[model samples]
Target: MRFKPLPADFYLNNTVEVARQLLGKTIVRNYGKKILAGKIVETEAYIDKIDPASHSHPGITKRNKPMFEKGGIAYIYFIYGNYYCFNIVTERKGKGCAVLIRAAEPIEGIEYMKKNRGKTKSVYELTNGPAKLCLSFGIDSKFNSISLRSSKLYIAEGKDENFDIVTAKRVGITRGTEFEYRFYIKNNPFVSKSK
Candidate 1:
């Protein structure tokens, strides 16, 4: 099957709508050593100015400059001093909105992902969380603000197996506890625990 990257228009719209539509899409990254890919099973919408819990709540900075870029760009950030959280910038340029890819199911280069993850043997842990999958794919701040359509980081359409969609509050956040912006494929084994 052909795996062309989705265009900017695909992400230059409503974040919630994009988040729901992203399910089952393939996220691929080739780091020279190996190619890692997975089917996105879960995502969360973060409308910066509107979402209290979004990192942009205070204001934009060097850390969040990527989020303000045009669509089809990666807004990767580091957390807990070690983990990297990846977000795809959405909407028009200067619109501080993004879709947080919460979970993915490994689909390509499984052995490479396992090697990158070191102790991960079960498929469940290969691409379950944002940090986990980034580690498995070798994504870091180096990818910050990279364009998805042209960069090594890209997403493609995938199989559409019937799945139940569920929406709930985003986890691991102290603010916007009432927004209930997180969404995941129901009964999916790959959804991140912060559902």
Candidate 2:
């Protein structure tokens, strides 16, 4: 099926709202001649200043520069000496806010995703977390700061399916625990975590 990327304006909305609304969107990655796609099942939002857990809270640097760019771009980062996490920059330029793509339900190019992930025992294990999603999609630093409008990586429209959304506190952070910035599709097996 043909996939059309979301318009640039879609990313200009509030980070938290974008994170929640992204639950059913399709994330498409063009890997060579094949197309790898997944339905976004989980997301986390981080806003500058207000969000202490946000990387941009420390201000723009070489590492977090992408988070300050205009909305509709990628803000990928590495952590724990390994693993890449993919995020979509949101709001206006210099806003330093974004929605992290925490998990996705593999839809297209399952074989390619499995090959990239290497020996996944179940389909749910493929793109069920931020790092896993990036690994399955072959995303890394090279993809950072690029336009999501590009065919290489983009969030496309998904099938019209109704699903309840769940909101919870962001995970893997000590600060900003008071804010419930994480969102996921209710009962989605591909969600990174359910709580």
Candidate 3:
């Protein structure tokens, strides 16, 4: 079935709430005649100041300006000097909140993702991590600050099957690790790092 991209208003909510609710959403990337799509399976919420792990905690910088924009934009960032991570700007304008997209289950363009990832092993290896997911879907710094409501890159509604949603501490972080801001589908093999 065809699904419409979610409206900006759908992201203008509490950061944590938005993160939890995004679990079953579909992330779509249109590349000319090729389309890459996946079901969001893992996410982490970050609220400016309130969440010590957030990039906005230390105030806005050139790198994190997108997170300060109104919800429904991409907050792509480079990490480990090797991989790009994707996030969805959330909350109201200037709030500097976002939901980190940690992992996804490939739904379309699996061949493209496999080619991008250079992996022929298993589907789980293609997008089972933040960096992997970004690479698999061809997400990079170029997508930073882009609107999620746009045609090229957007989020669509997906199945809300009877899967249990689990919450845990954010991973690979030094601060705010105590906050249970990380969410994922229980028993889903696509989760980046399951607890």
Per-residue lDDT value at 126 in model 1:
83
lDDT of 2 at 190: 90
Per residue, candidate 3 scores C-alpha lDDT tens digits across 14-84 of 99999999999999999778999999999999989878889999998999999999999999999989999
Q: Which regions of candidate 3 are displaced past 4 Å? A: none
Structural similarity to truth (TM-score) of each candidate: 0.94, 0.97, 0.96
lDDT of 2 by residue, 46-115 (tens): 9999889999999999999989999999999999999999999999999999999999999999998999
Residue-pair clashes, model 2: 0
Best by lDDT: 2
RMSD of 1: 1.4
Candidate 1 local accuracy as lDDT? 0.85
Residue 123, candidate 1: alpha-carbon lDDT: 86
lDDT, candidate 2, equals 0.92
How many clashing residue pairs are found in candidate 1?
0
Better of 2 and 3 by TM-score: 2
Candidate RMSDs in Å, in order, are 1.4, 1.0, 1.2
- The Cα local distance difference test for each model comes to 0.85, 0.92, 0.90
